[model samples]
Target: MFLGIDVGGTKMQFAVGVGEDVFVLNKVPTPSRYAELLQVVEEHCSEAEKRFEYAGKIVEMGIGIPGTFTKERVVWVPNIPCLEGQDLAGDLRTRLGAGVYLGNDAQLALAGEVWKGAGRENSNAILMSIGTGIGGAIMIGDRIVKGRRGAAGALGWLNLDASVPGDKNHGYLENYASGTGIAGVGETHVPPLSTYEIVAKAKEGDSFCRKTMDRAGHLIGAGLASVASVLDTEIIILSGGLSEAIETFKKPMLDSFIEYAAPGVEQVPIVKSELGNLSGAYGAVRLAMVRGDMWIG
Candidate 1:
């Protein structure tokens, strides 16, 4: 058995994995302070130890962070500000009295796909996580791309419009295409519709919402086109809350991709995540399996 934690801006997900099956333990609101975050995680770990069948059978643990991290320290977590510069893996190890591994959430999500979901048969793949913010991860010949500072696939910052100034925090692509970005567009006309509601309205034949989603889909496709051209990815996987609207986004996005992508790149298959939101948790377990030492005691 293994423990996997996926940390997000709004919520934190916990799961336990045994063999090929992964079971979610619980979810909790993410804390804003570093100390509180640690306490919450420890509490959950204690509960899992006492309540779950795995108990003493658990071998290793893995945690997925939404931002950049190194072997021992979390270098930069923008959404969860308090996590920056903390030695999260080390602290968790001490608190749990077991080995803990850390990985970038997007990267680990892709790992989960490769291990048990969509990318299982592909050695070269790309994943775009498009929820509150956009994140990316690339697997080239089975090796995950991690740039010098472990920020290689920070796709949200991809500049689509050079003429206008971009947001220093969320970046250009995220400003117009992410879930928050989509909701921002809806706010002007619909007055408080969420991205999901906007997509629903579009599906229900609302022209205004439909057009809005089309534009966003086109933009997302353009960004994906650029990525495909550069990486020559075998497959592109989409995950996150907004990906549920793939039915609305697919055609326009594919059309836009055909318009902008390099010749053969446009043919690359784009698919939804098979593991859905749990991809990160499964990937966390894979991370532990690959990087952590087996517990013998």
Candidate 2:
């Protein structure tokens, strides 16, 4: 059995599988402290090791974090501050007594896609995830594009509006297109709503909610256009929580893409994730199996 963990800002998804498909999956709320986070993960790993079908048999493990990191040490994780500067991969390897790999969450999702999802057979692809924040991963010529700082696909930092000054802390794209960003706009109404609630209301034909999603979708599409213009990737896979409501905003997003995209860029296909939210976990497993020594930094 191989273990994969996708660590997000608000939750952690643990998946155990033999190959491309998961056997068991579990989710837990993300703890604020690094120690608590490690404890929770260790507990889950122990449980998986004890499962009857997989008892005393483990091959490798991989963890995906939502920020920049080297092979074993985390450099920065803005959403989860406590994880910054931690050697999570080393710690896990020591505790589990098995080979462990670590990678950026979005990058791992792309790896998963390449292995068995939308990007299968494609050498070039892009992945964009919009949840509490926006992130992306890029693949070119069959290799993950890790910049010198290991921040190659930090898509949220893409600046669409250069005229107005943006948030000092968060990226402009993330400030308007993330789940939290959508909820921020929803909060301005007479009665506030969460991102999911707003999406549900929009599906029910609520005008305000629909407009909110449309605007966010437009912004997201614009960002994607910028990406497509540069890399001309074969496909763009959309995942994460906000993507679940894509039906509500897909039109506006496509419309904006057509409007801003370079000639021929509009033809690029943008699709939903085949693996959905578990793309990262599957990716972790894939990396663990194939690229255990792949130096992300």
Candidate 3:
């Protein structure tokens, strides 16, 4: 058995799975303190191991954090600034007494989509997760396109409008298009609503909500246009919390893409992410158990 944990900014998902089928799982709110997050992992692992009698039987464990991780196990978590440069894999092996691997959450999520979800049938695809911030990953033949610095397919930070002031602040496309970003715009107006709730209210004829999502879709499409121009991928897979309203924003997003995509770069498919909320956890399993070389095959 293998264990995969997807660590998000607001929550954590633990999965014990063999291949694509998960046998056991758990979810918890994310802890702000870095050490407390580690404790959560230990607790979840202990419980799962006991439930499945997997203490010594589990050979490899993988964890995906919503930040940057290097091959040597160094992590640079931007959101969780306190956890920056922490050697998470080393700590996990010492504490859990097992082999472990660590990787960026976006990479893991793309891997899951490739192995068992939306991109299963395709070799080259891009996953664009619009959440707290726009995140993206590229999977080619089951291998994540992790570049020299392990920041491949990081479309969020791309330079689109060089003339736009503060472009640096919104380099990651999610900064402008993510649900969190949208909510940030209306922070002073209405009670805060999650990405999903905002879209829901829009569908129920909330004018403000509709405007917010449309604006978000426009910004996302612009960023995606840049991705398409560069990668020319098979498809763009949308996941994360805000993706629940994909049906609502698909046309508007596409319209914006049409307005932005250069000539001769048409025909790329944009579809709702097939894996939904489970991709990150499933992706974590792949990252944990499969070596970097193994995923290429």
Q: Please, what's the RMSD in Å of model 1?
A: 3.7
Runs in model 3 with CA error above 4 Å? 31-36, 54-56, 184-198, 206-208, 262-265, 294-297
Question: lDDT for each of the candidates?
Answer: 0.84, 0.85, 0.75
User: Candidate 1 at 224: error in angstroms?
Assistant: 0.8
Error of 1 at 33 (Å): 3.9
Per-residue lDDT of 134 in model 1: 88
Q: TM-score winner among the candidates?
A: 1
- Stretches of model 1 off by over 4 angstroms after superposition: 50-57, 190-194, 292-297
Model 2 over residues 237-261: C-alpha lDDT tens digits?
Answer: 9988888889999999999998999
> What TM-score does candidate 1 get on C-alpha atoms?
0.90
Q: Give the local distance difference test score of model 2.
A: 0.85
After best superposition, candidate 1 residue 123: deviation in angstroms? 1.3
* Every candidate's CA RMSD: 3.7, 2.6, 3.2
Which portions of model 2 miss their true places by more than 4 Å? 19-21, 29-40, 52-56, 293-297
Q: How well does candidate 3 score on lDDT at residue 91?
A: 84
Q: Write the per-residue lDDT of candidate 1 for residues 106-187, one digit (tens) a residue.
A: 9889888988998989989999988888888888888778666566788888789999786778878888988888889888
